[model samples]
Target: MPNMLLGAFPIGTKSGANNSTSNNKNGKCKFLLLCGGYILFLILGAAMFSAIEAPKIDAISKRVQSFRKQFLQSNACLNDEDLEEFLKAVITANDRGISPLRNATNEMNWSFGQAFFFSSTVITTIGYGRVTPLSQTGKIFCIIYAAIGIPLTLVLLSAMVERLLVPARWLLGTFNSKLGHLYQPFNIRLLHLSAIVFIVITLFFAIPTAVFAYIEPTWGALDAFYYCFISLTTIGLGDYIPGDGVSVDNRSMYKIFISGYLICGLIAMMFMLTIFYDIPQLNLGQLFTESTNGETEKLHLSSNNTTCYSGPSGLYMPQRDEDTRRAIVRIRPHGDDSPSPDEAPSSLNSGIRVP
Candidate 1:
């Protein structure tokens, strides 16, 4: 009995150890899943908010605009007689109660405002339903128009980005090659990222901001910068709009010019994002994925950063060393009981050494 008990002790101890380790792993996995679920929830909530909030704000803004126009017209005649008449007319109208809602026809004078709005929608890809093409021909044409124009705009932006990426990649390489010994790979990548950000601010933001301020009436430097910032981000509040300076005789030409400006500006901003992606460190979260491998991993982030795992080889490198990090991954036996480095056995005893 004593001998039997002695032999069983290690087995029982190992079994308990295994259970503990398994529980730890399961706990980790559960925590990760919960975190992922929370992130997904936030993303969905944000998208829903954006879809609903924008149109509601736009409706409120239109109402405010109408009220402002009425106020200005009333204030135009401040003298006693005209003021009294205007006040009486406003009082009578208020008593009768103006329609709280406007039909599409009533907002015709605000069409130019909606053009600025359409420009914003185009950039953001939001295309809300409140204002739309009234004529059948216009409606049919709009569908075909967006299909072609959106892709063409994307292509133009992508091509420009490709061109810009070459120089950006080269610059990063030069910095890495020269200062590699002085810093960790991540540090070098950070320096390179800073350079790109500096260029983006100087070329796309500051200069354009200055030019816009000079050209547009009612725009100071801050307002111009705000317009450029909002338009580039595709927020497009549609307030502080431009190109209203042209006389009524040249309205069509003015509209065309404004349309061209918005499109070109939007494309240029997209190209800036492309240039930003050329920096590997900034893109680490996005680029980490399952399909990536040893050779491809060496391309940018892999080349500079130290991988933390060695798989079966027991060599610890950078996090990017493993391919498909973002991919849904499952660990299992490779058939011969030979454990892949990624699935090496945990140190705890009694746990099934599946790897």
Candidate 2:
């Protein structure tokens, strides 16, 4: 009997090994295909963007050259070469946030407030490109500073988002109580997220847009709004920056306030994204990575007792939820469509709940 069992075990083990190897091959193939598709997507985006904008760039360059010629012709005192050299000097200085124009009222780039603002933009990854390190030493320092600071900033934001999630979850609860019966859980969750998004826009984007437009002499309403949107998205297009407009009193203080605004606005934007990702239906990641047993990719966040936005598998929440106030919905058992009343609908079904 022992010999027969051993013989059977060998065959079974070999079959299981074959299955494991086959699964691994499939996973690798899927990963490679996904990567190839991503690269193609990037190429497609680049082509489209260039097609739309390359002509505009060419036209701008031609216009700039024409202007340079006009300027050289008008000013007889400065020859072409001399004017070119002077303009190059001014342009170089301008790129480093230094104003070479005699009448320019812009603050010095390395002044205490302006330097602090630049540092803020660096760590926040909102590299506006309006000011930049030119020296080799400064550039190297920037590389190291960003490498260390970006992750630290993300960690800080994660902790802030975790605590901020508490109130957001409570807001979900309020919605659930008010409209849990009238609509499906998913709809209520959508409305809840929408409400929070509206509030966030009002607080971080809309109000700030109004103030920036009011204070920034050269910026119209649209420009101020565009700046707010770009800054919050961290695109930092650099076309417009706060306190960089025409003469303004206390411009240094204005830059400092703008730096603080970026910090708070980013935190609020992250909180909004957290809420959006909390909805499992919106997790496009599940489509790519769900497994046969219904599990998918998972991440564990142990530090600060905080959790990231778990894509599709489960709550980033720990096995035992330590915080009662956090409204996390857990996945129900596979093949068990009917849940007991005590179980209530897990986060999977409702996308939100107390237990």
Candidate 3:
């Protein structure tokens, strides 16, 4: 037998101290580069976002300023400072989904349906920041509620992901059977993931996009698709919401259904992520982490006349050369004539040497 194990083993201490030190240095360098790259990525995202969004922010600021000036002009008695304070309060209220104007026709934000939507979003970590607790009591309750509910939501979603994985694995198996000989396993797995992606996009994204675009007055195709992606990814930008318009019929039902859609869509998103993470080669964590020693201390003993039996390794076991019948051996004390089925065999004759 060889002194080392091979075939897909981790980094072992087979090399010298110099090689280990070099590998440690390389790992440190890789880690530092990863940190630098991540910071650069963040900066890049910030720069691009500023470039793309600054114009819209300026336009909104201008519109709000114009509205403020117009309001002051119409209400001649109200001074600029007074209107500013009033507008601040109105903005605060609006931030919490409380409309200051009397033109509102929808149900109150705390109504059962809206509250249900808020709770679901909160637990799922998809908080849109659109509706929020105004009172200290409600805020405290929200903290407590989230503390208890988030884990429950994760447990529920994780169960769904696990159940979904069975079918996903089965699909991968089917793909392997059909194309295993023609393509590599990685390629076949990619094809399986692609098929699942297509199905998820069709059912959760494409169909919902069409439905939402049809029903939502302001949403175009791009907006609907964008909303689905953002919400399912738990981004929850709060820029747009379905079934929020005053003209929406049966708005409560709509909100409830939208909440359900968000939950289901989130599950589908998690399922895809699970599939992606299942592919070890695609995992990025391995790039950032270093392996420890994986070698085991092995001892082997052999003698010419002694029989030997090697134990099992995984599914592979040493085959038996001969079969031994399983027969019960019973022993009792010499003075005991009655049958003693519970007596151990060692009581009659001590251990026997095989060699």
Candidate 4:
């Protein structure tokens, strides 16, 4: 009977020891599976995007080649030495003076307003490349300025977004109050996200596109919309830029205003992204976490020393002092030499005892 009692006491301990090793192995397996899944998804997505874009890319390449061949064959000036010399003279003229494409008025590219605009673009990572620093001194200044400015801009944007979250959460709370009884929490959260997305798109994309179209003579609605999308997304393709083709009445002021618009639009986009990520259903990262029930069980077991077992009522109960007494009585033998209840072995004491 003593041997049986001793054997039963170690059962929980042995299970716990086995569980620790199994938990570690399970965690490692989960990590590897997640990594492999991510790699596979990335490869599949790349292949899918390439397949979708390849036909248009090939068509554009063929058209560009044909245009180049036709232009070279049709133009007799290409075969003339005098024309070639003229081209060389034009290149040399660019070295002496500002490129005609940059500022036809011969105004300095390093003017304070233009420099400020350039700095904003660089720090924001827009890099339009329309007007670049031409001198060695200017290039060196740009490098130093960007290194400091990028972090400062990031901090400013993050602070602004953090404050913005106050109203965002309030908006979510309002939605919950209105819809909580009728809908699941996930659905209500999705609706809240949609509201933010709509506001961001209207304020940043739609309104800016309209304003840009009205201001820039060359840009139509579609062109302005595309420019706004590309700029805010930080793609910065540099193909279609405002205030570049034809000189306006106040070009420097226009550039500065565009820079301001870019900064605000980026902030709005960041806010939208933050709200989107806050919705756990949309976040793929939640997949890597353990289930809620399993996590709860692990946390409970780790914090308490008492063993859990089924009681007479078929409910699981932690083995506290009262349960320890019952276990001792069951394990006691019928011999007269057996110890009384009060003289039971100290090893049979509760694992967790209140003081």
Clashing pairs in 4: none
Q: What TM value does model 4 have?
A: 0.63
Tell me the spans in candidate 3 whose CA falls farther than 4 Å from its real position.
1-17, 74-77, 100-103, 290-355
lDDT of 3 by residue, 133-246 (tens): 889999999999999999998999999999999999999999999999999999988898888899899989999999999999889999999999889999999888886765
TM-score of every prediction relative to native? 0.48, 0.72, 0.75, 0.63
Tell me how far the alpha carbon of residue 134 in candidate 2 is from the true structure, in angstroms, after superposition. 4.1
Find the 10 residues in a row with the least total lDDT in model 4.
3-12
Best-first order by lDDT: 2, 3, 4, 1
Using TM-score as the measure, the top candidate is 3
The regions of model 1 sitting more than 4 angstroms off are: 1-132, 245-264, 278-281, 284-355
**Mind giving the per-residue lDDT tens digits that candidate 2 earns over 224-245?**
8999999999999989988875
Between prediction 2 and prediction 3, which has the larger TM-score? 3
Cα lDDT listed for each candidate:
0.57, 0.77, 0.74, 0.73
Best by lDDT: 2
Cα lDDT tens digits for candidate 4, 131-163: 777789979988999999899989988999999
As a TM-score, model 1 comes out at 0.48
Give the higher-lDDT candidate: 3 or 4.
3
Q: lDDT for model 4, please.
A: 0.73
